[model samples]
Target chain A: MNLPQPLQELIDQFESLPGIGRKSAAKLAFYLLNVPQDRLNRFSQALTDLKVKTHKCDRCFNLTENKRCSLCEDEGRDQSLLCVVEEVTDLLVIEQTRKFNGLYHVLYGRIDPLNNLGPEEILAPQLLSRLVKEGGKIKEIILATNPNMEGETTAMYLKSKLEELRTKKSLDFKISRLAYGLPMGASLEYADYGTLIQALDHRNGF
Target chain B: MNLPQPLQELIDQFESLPGIGRKSAAKLAFYLLNVPQDRLNRFSQALTDLKVKTHKCDRCFNLTENKRCSLCEDEGRDQSLLCVVEEVTDLLVIEQTRKFNGLYHVLYGRIDPLNNLGPEEILAPQLLSRLVKEGGKIKEIILATNPNMEGETTAMYLKSKLEELRTKKSLDFKISRLAYGLPMGASLEYADYGTLIQALDHRNGF
Candidate 1:
């Protein structure tokens, strides 16, 4: 369309994001152009900070600034319990409820067979190693993955693998799954804090 | 909402954008965070470049890098016929048709009394001055303002002002208003190129 190279480049970048189409990209680019210079600079700086400053916690694989995430490092949190979530954002969802005081383990993804993403693709090996190494201190491992088919499969896979580890290592840690009162196929992002809190409270053993 | 400082900063910036609510802002911020570093950098650079490189054309007030806009500088375009639009995006819409060879004048805004915008708020006075100073060579002034209430009001006001200028300066140019065959209250943004071209072709003299 002979748009200025900068404008076209911006549109292409915006279109690369999930759920954003070419039309929406163009709209966003134009909107950015109209915004004040100081605001644009802040937006750009935020992007840089998000990439440069944010890092995955070694213990939980959650986005964090330190080796251990806030939940993992907090002395007041229940170190004996760990909530396993599919993504870092899911951890944020759980945290917003102000209910869960336990630590967390983020898989960063789910087992999507259609996309050829199995257990290994989601850092399951690392999680198993962590559990085996720290099995005595950990009292419970809560499977809080999403309620979708992939989430269910991942949970089942994790449960069996943990069971196998327990049989081999003779670990006595309890294994559980978050309650499924949440509507099927809904993302943790959309679920209200109250519902998520209730679901976490009523979690059942897997 | 105990979001991390960096994440919260990004969400706040997204919320500052026009038409973006808190929920949508959070979604957009997360969407940006998920984008690859290189892509995010490119988008951020594009935003800065859009503001730094783009400038209003001296003659037409349309967004351009050069002193005169591409349309205004083109020798083959009909200098005698000028199309006045409300924004630079509207100029792009007209240019895409390839049917009109006329120069464009961007008002940057429409006159709305409710917003305390009158004749001085838009480019009406400057356009009238240009018409009078261009001598008898200029044939037509096409008022292609948007079809909304503000656009209609601006067009009617401009028509009267131009008529008064024509009598006072003894100029012989014909002032025309672009046809509004499309549905009322529909923005030029939503109109297809073909429909817009048809509307432009069927304009009537005011």
Candidate 2:
């Protein structure tokens, strides 16, 4: 492939992306070549600004330019309830629901022990300290991590730690996990056994 | 979704790429966010350089960093034999085969009236002038445009023009189209009718 040096470099960059392969990278590179020069520059600026203009919030670890994220700064949101999530992406999905008006604590990752990713790397200690600093204002903490194995383990670990803190500090806040059940628009016949079992155990009245 | 402004902008940039949807764009943006800042800067540089460091070849319209593309500059290649292709991608594919060592004239596009694209938009005049300038040195011109409708129309159009030039200017170059047939490793049972007909029409002796 006698592609120009810059074109070949762009293809390599695209190939480094998560889902894009060598062929797709070449296609993307060619597609970008056709885009207007100004538009390509804008795309480059966006890539450069992505990291420079964003940082983790001091309170919740959610991505933000300021010391605290917008959600943490909003007084109208329910400060009494804090939703703990594995990443900012998860927090964004929950925010899209328009149901949870509370604040969030983004762990930034789950505890995958096999990969050597422990609770410490995910800001678990920071979450605990933030909880202690919030004092009794936060009445409930929702363990809204993913339902997968790593998420479950992280949530359980947080639960035990929260309980110990409650006993030691005489705090009154309660810790709870998200409910397990079949998702909407899913057929019962196609549901996996684990999902079916969870749905059965946490079944609600009709 | 409460995403940072820069993060959202990067997602929009990714979404603008061909074949990437909003979901995939968001995933790509998030994935890039986790990458080290130095790597992000390098990716940005690649995007910036894609247009800044490359331009169309003066001779063949193929992409190049110089006035003429490497293929057009190679003295070892068969200058007397020229292959006309629809785009640089097609030229790259032919180059990968390593069978044809001839020069190329990239039309950059085919004749598509539906899209209002014509010969003028595809550098057809330049190709004619190039052939005229070469005098009688070029012996053959292979119409290697794709076999689809637009490609076939372009090939036919070029063939008639070349014939007119040959007669009017007393040139001696021969024009030829790529042989159409069932592709290798393709089962005849699943071959299309058009391909089957072409295979029968152009059958070769063992």
Candidate 3:
């Protein structure tokens, strides 16, 4: 008697996604319905496959299809330098440039006290442990976390924690945060390629 | 040395969706990777199931799981009055109010000559045949097509065609169109419920 219940249900599901409101969700649902059955199937399968086939690298926390991420497994990469980011997408953006030969550590999220997300909620502990355990091979740690309030706070927290680890172990590896010339509050994912490259070039000691 | 090739491919596919764009698509793809496998499967299956489960109603051309749409099958509906719309989504909007007990005919699209979409492209022939085939049981045809140029042109074309049909059959039935006091160039999907109801109430004979 009304819109097919399944169609409405799907539209509601889409609306629940981040950045999608009611109107956009409805349009997306209708567009999906109109797509060819094969394309829809492929799109759906891709969503399911993303979860089934991919996982966080135990070492760096970047998404991977194997036990360790491609960066960690690649012998040609500069193992002495590591770039840390807030999410896997950030890693992908940096990777697209073909400039960074270092490994990456995905925090999975940034520290947001307002959202009840703290240092422990992210992969901070694991990242610190990896740096300490592999202190001999890694000469520098690049804090490429996003240039936002939460990102700055998280970077500061990690910097202090890594400093404590270095003092306790008598290690001398350098730790640095990304440059702040980028527009404030802008996500690393949306930063222009040139801005990201410039930020990476101007990174300084934390 | 980066995100897996398949994962990158999947993100590119998400970007291809309408209104998804690059940044939002990456977010969605990453979100998909983070979601539980079972939940991702359900979302993916829903996408494919939407098109597979729904089919055009033979009688009204509305999206339905059966031969006749729920509105057409309902016993309480006033079969004497029919509300014609451009799409199934539009029909759903009117049905949400529970005020119109009449049946519906979905033309699927309007007559857009500029886009090479004419009457034959949107099931107009079937609509006219249905009106004539209903015999004297149908007393009124309410045109609830949109208010855009294509909508207006389609309504006028349908009005002239229906008039010819009435003259040929020697029948007496009122033909009307929903009022246009609402804003122009806005889709029926975006119209508030109150506005749509008022437009229906103030409908004028074509």
Candidate 4:
């Protein structure tokens, strides 16, 4: 318990992160202690620079090293299709799939009524503004929030909001939700009841 | 992919830590972004000071802010008893039990042959010197390494080495390995064969 304040502080900082607990934080701190001094310095420098260097992409709210995110500026991606995700991590996951070729709008968070995070706390306004600013250039809006309860609520809210925008602004874009079904290669036995119901309800022709 | 260099660097550094990968690293980095700037600055300062503030206690090789670790300097602990462990984490685990009132000698690592880690790489020599310097003042040594393969090998090596030291220095201390048995409340049916055998071999007279 008599650790140097800095070492203890490092452990506390690590514990403050999402998944790390006391033991894991201590393990990481000790691991850092063994790491070469220059690497530790670089790591510290990186942490300091993370605050000084990075900012959100003004256009899409995506994190960027620049004034705008690469996805927002990329000419090759479809400008007419935008995927709305709850976070940049989701964007990265979708990017990994290589199936979606559209631009993204990272909401940073979804509506969680229990946690008191409403539409206002997240990037809902930015999303609306982005859609309006792009206008007829965007032909489709994909509601790609997570599949959980909050995500479902957020998707419904966005659906109504987008529908209102379409009616008021006469926007020429369509709104769609990501499909729900058993994941690829997953067995029906292991699939939960709700997922099975979704798979059954959304069955497609052979 | 065009993340600002500092954010990317922080992600890379987070990824370098044990158990943290690319996605978790990115999540931590992004989470740090939303954290208040002063908090981030404090985290950065903590990381920077970790190296500057911490050092190994010369006596036990345990991490400390000073020349000696708290356990090594505590007057209330039994100086006659020393528990040898592979890491500080192990020391912490033993301390949590509150069953032992002895000092510790942290090996800092186990003798992992497959990883090419030998006695020389760890703090085996320091344990030997400490034992010699303390001589007849120390009454017992508990080899409290973990119950795994690497820990077992390390314990065996330490036992033999300490025996040699006892003979050379004419030390009058008892060297004991921690008892092996079925963990408290664990079912005999669930116990593995090796563990059952150990429990049977070390069974006490009722």
Candidate 5:
């Protein structure tokens, strides 16, 4: 026999999520059947509030509940050095490292030509306008997008645009992309070919 | 900076689910952020209805929206044969095989001494009462519980109780257990010692 309507609907919703299969979805639905009513209600409330209670930062496009994100509002952050990333999650990952004191610009996506995404599809225009508005105050713009092909394409596109703007508008910010090499603690035996080549080309002086 | 409150709560809820880690929870929460408002609402509604709109089948303990589950209400099924399982999920698994037309009894859980669960903690008493109610109608009782320790304990306990009831009430049902052997597609080299021993003990005629 088929599952009850409510259970079936919940299973279908769970299956629609990334990486969850039909069996896993049904398992989750079954597990939730025994959860306390209040906890289930809280989970449902959180789902409803996830989109309703949050908005994007006006300046950087990072997620926020207020007019601007905490990173954007903090005056202690280094405004002169901005890091541009492809998504809010990437910004959060960098923030967790506690190494970056500068503000961030969330591009929302990368330049994926295979999927019909271009520079225009991302927040490239917004980044340029923001830079133009900031003028000479920002000394450096870090392209911290992912290190894949689409990320490389986005960084290259942004770099050329920033260089053209530097000459045309007399901007003073230097553009830089994230360094490429073997990840820390990763063995050379397992490292991919592209990473090995990049490591050799960008070898640090002893 | 930490995630927004609503997003963080959703992530925490996702993390509480079995097999979902912190990173996967965050990924699911972020993925849902982009889901359409209507879909999100539907997902939220489903979660609310999962518990509120469904209940245990009065006769068999399987999950159902109505008083009696479809399995119990069906007149075409073989009421004389009853298969006792540990959970509703197991009943569904057996039903998916489509080999059994018999009615089912869900024990809800198994006896586990490590967890302090006894025969009374499960639906053993309920099963006895149901057998008494059915009396001589049920011709055979299949112990279809899992082959694990707790399942074995539950089945053993139920068998003794059924034997006592059969003597007292003069019920004519014969009790039986599912066979133990190698699973269909499992290789002999990889099969565990217990399975190999069981397969040897229960060798079938060619």
Candidate 6:
């Protein structure tokens, strides 16, 4: 109850975050107590620069400090393939799979009407313009949003929008969604009903 | 893959703390991006002051910014009783119980032999000096260390040390340990064997 002011404030700030609880907040505040003043200053500087120095990439809406993100500037990656992800972290997850070697479009968030979030709230227009401006370069657009309800809605909306662009400009690029199936190492008995239905509906001969 | 410098640094710092992993680190970094610049400044200031402003209280070794912690300075608290704990956070946990009205002596850490931590590494000497200074005023000493092996070892060591001090000063005070029992709402089948044995050994009148 008589915790020092700054320590208590730090704990309060930590508690305000998404997953941190009261015990963890206290642990972190006390753990930070042992860190030297110089390290604390560096941490503070990092926090200050976290918001001040970072901005969304103009082209891809990915996090970056420059006019464009590194992925967009890198000429080594495949330019004809574009992966659309719900957030920059999803792009990171895709990158970790080491299977996708193309550019990315970060939507920043998905459309969820129940949560009062609409197309205008996110980076939907940026994605539209990027598609329009770079139509000739991109050959395939992969919709990699989450497989949940909101993600399905966003994917459908983007699919229609991409379809309209393709028809209007007669773009040669293909619009595709990630396939549904039981994940690797998953058992069939425990698989969700909708996923199993999708897998059955889209089954292919080996 | 293309995270900016400051955001990456903050993520790395967050990852270095206990219990935080890579995914949570990135989530925290990106979440901090949405926090306003003024709020970020306050959070940064709190980090700056966490170590710089806090030090161990000279009397009880509880964390404080002043000469003595508020608990030690409070005249309303029972001055005749003192609770010895392994760390300041342990004292906080006991405070949450709202059953203890005595002062506390924080040893700062348990005797973790596997981690190369011993009595000398923590505030054991400070506790000894405090006991010597205030032995006449204190009538009861409670060893409130954890119930695990290391905690039991630390409490035994402290008990012997306190017994030596009591013999040297001919101190007239009682030393006690917390009662062993089945905790409220704990299932008998789920209780560990050692705890169950201790409960049986310390069984009192029904």
* Candidate 4 per-residue C-alpha lDDT over A13-79 given as tens digits, one digit per residue, 9 for 90 to 100: 9999998998889889989987888898888788777867777889887878778988887899998
Interface C-alpha RMSD after superposing true interface residues, each candidate, one decimal: 2.2, 1.1, 2.2, 1.9, 0.7, 1.3
What stretches of model 2 exceed 4 Å from their correct place? none
Q: Kindly indicate the candidate among 4 and 6 with the higher lDDT.
A: 6
> How do these models rank on DockQ, best leading?
5, 2, 6, 4, 3, 1
Question: Candidate 4 lDDT, tens digit per residue, B110-181?
Answer: 899999999998899999988877768888999999898999999899989988988888888898989999
Query: Between candidates 3 and 5, which one is better according to TM-score?
Result: 5
**Model 6, range A1-206, lDDT digits (tens) per residue?**
47977789999989988899988998999898887788889988999888778888888888888878888899999999999999988998898888988999999899999999998977878877887887688999999999999999999999998889888987888989899888889899999999899889999999
Provide the TM-score for each candidate, comma-separated.
0.83, 0.96, 0.81, 0.83, 0.96, 0.91
Residues B91-126, candidate 5, lDDT per residue (tens digit)?
Answer: 999999999999999999999999999987898898
Candidate 1 wrongly placed segments (more than 4 Å): A181-206, B181-206
User: What's model 1's lDDT at A193?
Assistant: 79
* Comparison by DockQ, 3 against 4, better one: 4
Q: Which model, 3 or 6, shows the larger lDDT?
A: 6
Across A120-187, the per-residue lDDT of candidate 1 in tens digits comes to 79989988899877767788999998877899899999999999998899888899997656667878
Q: What is the lDDT of candidate 3?
A: 0.82
Fold similarity of candidate 2's chain A to the true chain A, as a TM-score: 0.96
Docking class of 1: acceptable
lDDT of 3 by residue, A1-206 (tens): 66676677778768867888998888888888878888887777777677667777889877788888878888998988989899877887888889899988889899999999998899999987887788678888899887767988899998999889889988878999765556779899898877888778877689
Error of 4 at B18 (Å): 2.2
For every model in order, the TM-score on chain A comes to 0.81, 0.96, 0.80, 0.93, 0.97, 0.95
Q: Docking quality tier of candidate 4? A: medium
Question: Lowest summed-lDDT stretch of 10 residues in model 6 chain A?
Answer: A126-135
Docking quality of model 3: it rates as acceptable
Clashing pairs in 3: none
**Alpha carbon lDDT of residue A173, candidate 5?**
84
